[model samples]
Target: MKRLLKLYLNTFDGLSREVWWLALITLINRAGTMVIPFLSLYLTEDLEFSPSTVGSIMAAFGLGSVVGSWLGGKLTDKIGYYKIMVFSLFVSGLLFVLLQYLKTVLSLSIGIFVLMLVADMFRPAMFVALSAYSKPENKTRSVTLIRLAINLGFSAGPAIGGLIIAGLGYNGLFWVDGITCILATLLLIQLLNPKKSKVLDEVKVEEPYSAYKDKAFIIFLFALFLFGVMFLQYFSTMPIYYRDSHFLTEPEIGLLLGANGFFIFLLEMPLIKWLENTRFNKVILIWFGALLTSLSLLILNFTTWSGILIIGMFLMTVGEMIAFPFANAFALQQAKKGNQGEYMALYSIAFSFAHIFGHKAGLESVSVYGFDNTWYIFTAVGVLCMFLLLILKQFLKAKNIIS
Candidate 1:
């Protein structure tokens, strides 16, 4: 037991105190993440919106995310990450409270868009902060620590959210989510002093559009966009599929989703530590991870059994664990000093783009072609993204862009 404990501690050895505080803030924020996972279900079942309408509303949230990420990146470079993060958290919390009162489709759609706009602006800022806090050699593990906190909080949130939905209902979810965001903001103010945080001292006055010029990075971002599209199905269409196709209740769906978080919490840090010590190529590892994501979705075509759903989610979580943190680390490596915010912001946009298209694709396909075909489509896209990543690796190697 002592040996195992020592090994676990060794995996997290070099990360700074600020990184741990960032992880704590992430855990607190995500622990109340009751909204996005259930937003589609709420629009469909509770409000009686059509699937298409739900998709549009969800896409609206993505639209806001797109704007938020771009704006956040620019702002982080100009004003620094501290102010941007604190502002995003407090305002987004108030927006969540406002979301509870919205009823009609137009109102809810507009509200959701605005809420996500404010909420998602924090993403790039947070990434910039993470990079600032971490030493170069420990960057990947630093990011993974934050992810571990996120997954741990996710494990708690959905299970508790299930109970909240069961008792106090969806309104209860909004309240809890809103309150937590406010609390996270307060913690940030108290714990993260600008003078104490280890931000990069060098500043370069590059144009906002500078990151767009790197062709290899552009290809990488596109591949990430595709991966994001497929991966996001877990939050978007997957819940609806479970509810409508399998006839599972909210609590059951929560448990299934929660299981993904539980697995990541247990495995991600150790897995990254192992990978760091190995001779395996980062590109190849990411490709395998992408392939696994497709396999996770393809498994759904074979069976809709409850046991199978859990298994599929587990595979998806594994893929996420392998791919995402490495992807972030790779992006950080590719970035020039003083441009981390711009690079990270561009990467964040890939997910926002996924939000824009993934929900539309999943919801529309289900509305038109049916669920099985939607899964098939997702599987095909994931495979295609793997090829893109492979090509990106070769390009980077040929150009000596990565060591």
Candidate 2:
């Protein structure tokens, strides 16, 4: 027990205090992440929208994310991550509060698009802030710590969100989400004023590299995009699957989703720390992770027993724990000091682009081909993603980008 405890604590030894604070802020912010998980259900059940309509609205959300990521990157470079984060949190909080009024499809679509545009602006800026705050050697662990916080909060969010939805309806989710965003912003302001604290000094790169011009990075992005599409189905279509196929109540679905987060929360840091100690190539780990994710989806087609949901989710969680932190660290390594925002922005945008198409494709495939076929397609995509990463691994080897 003592050895286990020490191993756990060792994972968090070297990250900066600012990174801890940032993780706290992320926890608080993500704890309020109640709406998006249930958005499709709301569109279909409460609003009575067709699957096609829900797909389009979700696509709008993705489009906003893409634009927001790009804008945040540009603004971070011009002004700084600190200011952009503040603006994004405050403005997005206001937008969420107002978003509940829109009932029509067009209005909801536009509202969500605008809300995500403002909300997602926080992502790239936060990544840049994280890079600045973490020690060079502790970057991946820092990412894992932040993800631990995120998943911990996410674990709670949906369960509480389920209760909220049952008690006050979907409108309640928006208000709660908005209030939490503002609360997180306040915490950020109090704890992490860059001017007041001198810990997170931004290192200026003498010559910043352009992410747009990086050919290898572009290939990496495509691989990352494929991973994102497979992962994101958890939020978008998987719930609907739980509802229609398993006849799960909202709270049950919430708990199932929360289980994924909780599993990650408990085990990811230790797993990441162990992986980092090994001399294994990070890309190989990423490939193995992707392979697990593919199998997770493929397993859904194995049996219709509701127990399979738990199995698949467990596999998916493991895959996520392995792939994501290394991917984040890899993206950070690709950037120079001053150009971190641009590189991370493009990185976020790759997932943003995945969001745009992934949800739509999942829903459409389900509609046309049935759920089993959809899982098959996703499994195939996951396999393709693994191959792309392997190709990238070879290219990186040739360029000596990573040993």
Candidate 3:
């Protein structure tokens, strides 16, 4: 354990001073993203609404996130990531404030919708900046570190939200998240000056930032879209899966999340490094995707307390750790010099759209088709993704797109 910590610390030691600061910015902004997980529970429990109603309300955020992902990136290209994040954070912060004070169901729903949009927009810009400034050699490690910081910050957010909500109800929770955003905004302005595109100038930026009319980037994006939809199950479907399908209690579900985060915290850096190459990453992704989709289906039948559901979540997270980084790294690698913001933004849009669809499907599947069927559907989706990836891999291999 001590050796692992030493190795993790050493990676940052090798990064340029500027990159270290960038990671800190990620840590700050992500630490405050506490409102997201708590929002659904807040609306349902505090506002006294039903699950289905809350599901629809939650869907509003997903829809807004889709817009944020596309528009945020576009704005980043025009104005710069620094300015764009400032606006995004401010808009999202205001929505968080609205969430704190607002009481009406209609008002609350709208507030969440706006908040989701703003929050989602802000993410891709940060990613674009990270990809821009980070050392090419350390790209995988850097990305994993950024991800870890996010998970760590978000980990605090949810635990704190649980406590705050338990004591002060949903309003107090929103107030906390609001304050966090405001603080993060102040830090963001000081940390990321968009004029600081100097770090980006050193690298051999990819060829002209085109639409990637090169069909490879296009095929890769579609594969990513499928992979993203599968990950959304953790938030949208997995929760319901554990509760309704697996008969786990609320506290138990929370523990499951905690466990997943814990393992990720432990393994993220090394695993990410090992999986850096596109082909290796894709292979691991395929394996994990297959296992995760199969486990989702198996959990429906293996609902006994021998920790089957927990194992299922672990498998799912493993798939997540493999697939998400692969998709992100591959997408970033394929973009042209000036198009980093655009590709990352479009990718974010794809993710947001997935969340929107995935959540609705999760809700409906649990309601109409039953939990077991949802697993089967997820499995089918994974299988389809695997086939798509296989064809893409072959094409890339022939063209020498991936080494």
lDDT of each: 0.84, 0.87, 0.70
TM-score between model 1 and native: 0.87
Can you list the residue pairs that collide in candidate 2?
none
Candidate 3, after superposition: displacement of residue 386 in Å?
A: 1.0
What is the C-alpha lDDT profile of model 1 across 270-335, one tens digit per residue?
A: 999999888876777778789889999999889657677878888999999999988888877666
> Which parts of model 2 are misplaced by more than 4 Å?
1-3, 40-54, 165-172, 198-201, 236-256, 300-309
Superposition error at 295 for model 3 (Å): 4.8
lDDT of 2 by residue, 200-264 (tens): 44568878778988877888899999999998888778999999988999889978987887788
lDDT of 3 by residue, 1-403 (tens): 9997887665455455555666676666676666777666666767788877887777777778887787887887777777777777777776777777777767767877777778878877887777767766666566677777778888877777778768987777667767777777787767666554447424344455564465767776676667667667778677876776567889888888788789888876767666553456454465465556556545656555637776777777776666666666666676544566777877777777776677677678778887767777877776776777777778878987652
Provide the lDDT at 110 for model 2: 91
Candidate 1 stretches with Cα past 4 Å from truth are: 40-54, 162-172, 200-209, 237-255, 299-311, 366-373
Cα deviation of 97, candidate 2, in Å? 1.5
- Which 10 consecutive residues of model 1 have the lowest summed lDDT? 200-209
Candidates sorted by TM-score, descending order? Answer: 2, 1, 3
Score residue 89 of candidate 1 by CA lDDT. 92
Sort order, lDDT high to low: 2, 1, 3
